[model samples]
Target: MNSQAIADRCEQADVELIRLLYVGNDGVVRGHAVEQDHVPDALESGVPLPELVQSFNALGHRVKDAQFDAVGEVRLLPDCSSFRVLDHEDRVAAVLCSLRDSESGHPWSADPRSALSRQLADLADEGLEAALALESEFHLVTDGEEPSPHGDQGVYSTASMRNGHDVILDVVDALQAQGINVHKYYPEYAAGKHEIVTKYGRGIGAVDDYVFLRETVAAVAESHGLGTTFLPYPFDGATNGCHVHLSLWDGDNRFAPSDGDRALSPMGRHFVGGILAHVPALLALTSPTVNSYARLRPQAGAAAYGCWGVENREAAVRIPTAAPGERDTATRVEYRPADNTANPYLSVLGLLAAGLDGIRNEIDPGPPLEADPANCDEATLTDRDIDRLPTTLGEALDALADDDVLRSALGEELTESYLTVKRSEWDAFTDSAATWERERLRDTF
Candidate 1:
C-alpha cells in the first residue's frame, strides 16, 4: 500500500494505524482477526467498517479487517503502532493490524489465531513445541441456480487434473503470494469440493497458517466471482467434510516410536489411540455443526468409525506409505473426522490434549488395521475397546459434559461459552426444515 493510499484509507475509515503485519496464513492479516485490539488511529478514525471490509477482503477473506465494535465481546492489548501488510522487498501487499481504546483494550479470544498463540506460548514455557498442518476439505458449490460443468469424481484421480484447474490455480496463487506453503490442492470425489495440502510449521504457527489459509481461500474465491462455503456440508451434499493433519515434537525429533513392525511410532500409535478413544468428546469440538453429523455417515468419507490405519485414507488417520525421507515433513497423522465449521484452534487443541494424555500414561496402541479399518468387526472391540467418535454433535456434547480432562484443557469459561453457542446452533438446525427432508418426509409425516 502507498503512503497516500493508506492515508486515504485511514481518512475514509476514520481509524488510525497501530500495527500491521503481512501474515502468510490468510494471505491477509488473518481471518480470526477479531473486532478487539485495533490501533488507536483506526479507532480514532472510526472507519465505517463496511468500507474498510473491502480493503480487508482485497487482502483476502482470511486476512480481514479487524472488526472493532463497541457492542462486541472481548478487546485488544496495549501497544505501539505498526500496520502489518505483505510487501515485496520494498513494497507492501497484505496487512494485519490492531487498535486500542486508550483505555485497556479487550483481547478477542474468539480469534483462532489469538487462542492458538496462547496455547503455543504455554507449550513454549514447558520447553515443548508443536508441529501442525491442515488437510482442509471443502465442497465446490456452483450456482444452485444453474449447474456448472462438473469435474471427474475420481477419488484422488489423475483425471481431476483436467477440471477446476482455474479455481484451484487462482486459490493457490493467492495463498502462495501471501507466503502460505501450499504443497498441493486438488479435486475431491465431490464436484465442487477439494483439498489443499501444505507444509507444516512448528508451535502455534501451523494452526495460524490454517486460519489464514481458510480465510484466504474463501476470500480469493469470492474475488474470482463465486461463493466459497466452508460449511462442512454445503447443502447436505453426498460427502461434506474437512480434516486436519497434525504431529507433535519438542524440536527436530518427531515424538515416540513404534513397538512393532507396524508403521506407527509408539508416540504416533498412542497419539492415534488417545484421539480415537477421546472421539466422542473430541468430535464436539472437531465437528461442531449439526450439518457435520449429516456428513459423517456410514458410506461417506466423513469417518464415522473411530480408527487408524497404515496408509488407509478411509480411516481417521492415514499414515502415507511414501518413502520415509521422501515426504518427511508430512510424517503425521491425518485426522479425517473434523469439519470446517469447528474452530481450528479448539479442534487442534483437543487433539493435543488427547495425544499428550496418551504420552503421559504410556498408552500402548496395539495392532494396526490391516484392511479397510472401518470395516473391522467387533472382534477388535472388546466392550472395553469398542470406543468410537460421536455419531452426532449432540452425542459429542454429552461426552464433553462428562469429560473433565477435555473441559479443563479448554478452560471453564471458554468451554461453557463455546458449548452454549453450539447448543443453540444445534437447536436451530433441528428446527429448520431442509429441502431434502421436507420433500422426502414432510408430506409422509
Candidate 2:
C-alpha cells in the first residue's frame, strides 16, 4: 500500500489518531501520537522523536556513550506497508517506522530496524530470502501482588485454554483485525501462562508483526481486567520465551531442506553451525536482560549450551519434525536461546548474520546431540562437546565485544551503545539489595 491508500483507509475508518511506532534497543515499544489532520504531513516529513528513546535502558536511563543526546532528533519515517487499524484503541491506527537521519534522510545506523534491513538486503544480494516467525509465551495475572489465576487442566489442554476463553478469543480477533495471522493459541505448562503462534512473514514484516502482537496482547489483557507480562521471570512460575523459527529460500528452491529425510543440506548444516559458533555473543541480543539469565539455566527448558539437535529442545538449534511431503515447505530451524525480552530486529539480524557467515565460510557443526545433555550420563558428553552458553549478562557482553564479525554487522554506534547501556544495567542489578542476599548472608554468613 502507498501513502495515498493508507490515507484513504484512515479516512474511511474514521481514525482520529495515528501512532508512529518504533521499538527500543531493549525491546520496549515507544511511539508518538499524531492527530488525524496531521497524518499526511507526519508521513511525508516523518515524526520527529529523540533518537535517545532507542538508546534508553530498561530502567529509562540514557546511555552516556550513545551520542543520541548530541544529535537530539531522528525522523520516524512511517512504513506505509505496515499500516494497521487498531481495534482495541478507539479511532486509533498505527504504522511502524524506521528511524532516519534528519539531515541526510538516510536510515539511522543506530536503529535496530535499519540494522536488520541491512542484513536482509545482503541476503537479497545473495539471491536468498528468509521467512521468519516468533512464538510468544506470556503469563496473565489478575494482580501482580497476588498469585496468578489458576486452571485445572494441564499444558496444551483445551479446557485450560477455555478458562480465559473470551479474552483469548478477543485478543486473537483484535490481532486478525489488524492483519496479524495467529496460527495457534493454547495453554502453556505454567499455571497462568499461554502461548500464541503467528504466521510467518518476510524480513521487516516479521519484526513488525512481533512488536504489534506484543502490544496487542498487553492492550487486550488490560481491557479484560488483567495484566500480562512477557518478562522472562515474572514470579518464578515459568519463564516467557519468544522462540524464533526460520527458513532460507532461493526462488523455487528451499535452501534449508526439501526432502523427507532429517538431514540438512550442506548450506543448511553450515547455517546451523554458524549460529552454534557465535551463540555466546548472540546471547547479548537474544536473551539480553539481567532477568533473562534466570530463565536460560541448564534445566530451565531453554537452551543452555551451543549445539544442534533433531527434535531436542535442549539444543540451541533444533530441526523440527515434519511429514515427508510437507518437509519441502515446513522444514526449518527452531532457535531456543531467545526470550520475549529480546528486541526482535536485533535478535533476528544477529541470527541471520551468524548463519550467513557460516554458509560463506562453510563452517562445520560437528554433530547433533542425540540425547539431552542435562538428562544424559556425563560419561558420553565432554565439557568441550557440550559448550555451555554464557551464564551471565556480563559474560555475554564480553563475548559480543570480542566478536568482530557480529559487531560490524550491528554497526559501531549500536554495538557500543548496546554494550554501554547493558553494562550499566548489570552494575545496577548487582549493587542493588535483594531479599535472598539479606535473608541468607545477613543471618548466616
Candidate 3:
C-alpha cells in the first residue's frame, strides 16, 4: 500500500489507532498502538519502542546477557507497503515495522526482520531472488485459556471444515481484505485443525504477509468466540506446522529444476544440500519451541531426518510434484521441518543463508529419498542414507552453537541473545516434571 492510500483508508475508516508491529525473537507479534492523529508523524519519524523488545524472552523478560538496558530505545519505521485495516477493530490499522538504531539511524543487528532483509539483499547482489509460500496449520477450538477442540471430525473431513466454518471464513475474508492472497483452506490431520495456503510472494513480502496472516487468524478467531493454537503439538497425537515452499530465480529463469538429468538444477541441488547440512542448526530458529521437538519424532509425518525427496512428505525437504502442463511448476522445494513457533524472519534468513552458502561452495545434495524414511524400519533408512535431525530443543541449540557458518550468518548479537533465551527455556523444562512425565511415570512406578 502507498502512503497516500493508507492515509485515505485511515480517513475513510476513521481509524483511531495505528499499530506499529514487530515480531520478536520469541515468534510473537508485539506492537505499540498509536492514536490516529499522531500516525502521520509516527509514519514519518517512526514509533519509539524499547530496544529490549528484541532482547526479551518468550515471557517478555529480558535475557541475562541482553545488551540494551531499560533506557535503550529503537525506532520502528512503519513499512507503509504492509499497512492493513484490521477486521476485529472498529477504527484501527496496522503496519509491520523494521527496527532502526535511534542514534546511528541504521538497521538494528538484533532485529530479525532486518536480518531477513539483509539476506535478501545479499541474494539480490548475486543476481538471484527467492519466492516463498507459507502454509500455516492451526487448530480452532471453543473459547477459554486452554481451549478444547471445536469438533471431533476425522482429519481432512468436510465436518472439520464445517465445524469451524464461520471463524475460518471470517479469517479468510479479513485477510483477503488486507490484500493477502488466500489460496486454499481445508481440514488438516488433527481434529479441529485446518490449513490455509497463501499465494507465493517475493522475499520479505512473503514473510510480512505470513506475520499479518497469523495475527489476523488469531484476532478473527477470537472475535468469533473461538480460540486457535499454532503450538506444534497443542494436543497429544496432534501436529501443527508452518510448511514453507521455496524457489529461486535469476530473472525469469527458474533455478529449482533444470531440463537436464535429475529433478533439480545444479544450483537447486546445492541449495538443498546447504539446507540439509544446516538443518540441525536451522531448527533452533525454524522449530524453536520445546513443544516443537515433540512433533519431530520418527514416523510422525513430520520429518525427523535431514533428507530431501520427490513428493516424499517424510523428507525434511520435499520437492513437490509439478502440476501437469506447467513446465516450471515442479521447480520448488517444500521444507517440512518448520513450525509456527519459529520467528518467520529468522527462519527465512537462516534458510536463505544456508542455501547461499551451498551455492557458493557448489555443495551436492546427495540422492533424493524415494520413500518415507521416517515411516520405514530402521534398516531401510540406514541402507538408503538418511540422518536424523535434532530431536530436542536443547540438542538443536547445541547444533546451532557448533555451526559457525550459521552463527556468523545470523550475526553474533542475535545468535548469543537467542541462545540465552532458548537455554533458559530448556533449563526450565528440565527442572520440572511435565504433565506427560507425570502421566507416564506416576503409574509406571
lDDT of each: 0.58, 0.85, 0.84
TM-score of each: 0.75, 0.95, 0.94
Off by over 4 Å in 2: 64-66, 147-153, 256-260, 377-379, 433-440, 443-445
Tell me the tens digit of each residue's lDDT in model 1 across 82-142: 2223221122222333222323443233333344556667767767777777778765555
After TM-score superposition, the amount by which residue 215's alpha carbon in candidate 2 deviates from its true location, in angstroms, is 0.8
Identify the superior model by lDDT, candidate 2 or candidate 3. Answer: 2
Q: In candidate 2, what are the lDDT values of residues 88-207, reduced to their tens digit?
A: 888999999999998899989889888899999988998989999998888887865665754543788777777878778989999999888989888988777888899988778988
Q: Put down candidate 3 lDDT per residue, 96-167, tens digits, no spaces.
A: 999999988888888888888888998898888888988898888787676777775587788877888888
RMSD of 3: 2.3
Instruction: Please say which candidate is ahead in lDDT: 1 or 2.
Output: 2
Q: Alpha-carbon error at 113 in model 2, in Å? A: 0.1
The C-alpha stretches of model 3 lying farther than 4 A from their native spots are: 1-5, 375-385, 434-445
**Candidate 3 colliding pairs:** none
lDDT of 3 at 114: 86
Q: Measured by TM-score, how close is model 1 to the native structure?
A: 0.75
Residue 152 displacement (Å), model 1: 4.5
Positional deviation of residue 45's Cα in model 1 after best superposition, in angstroms: 14
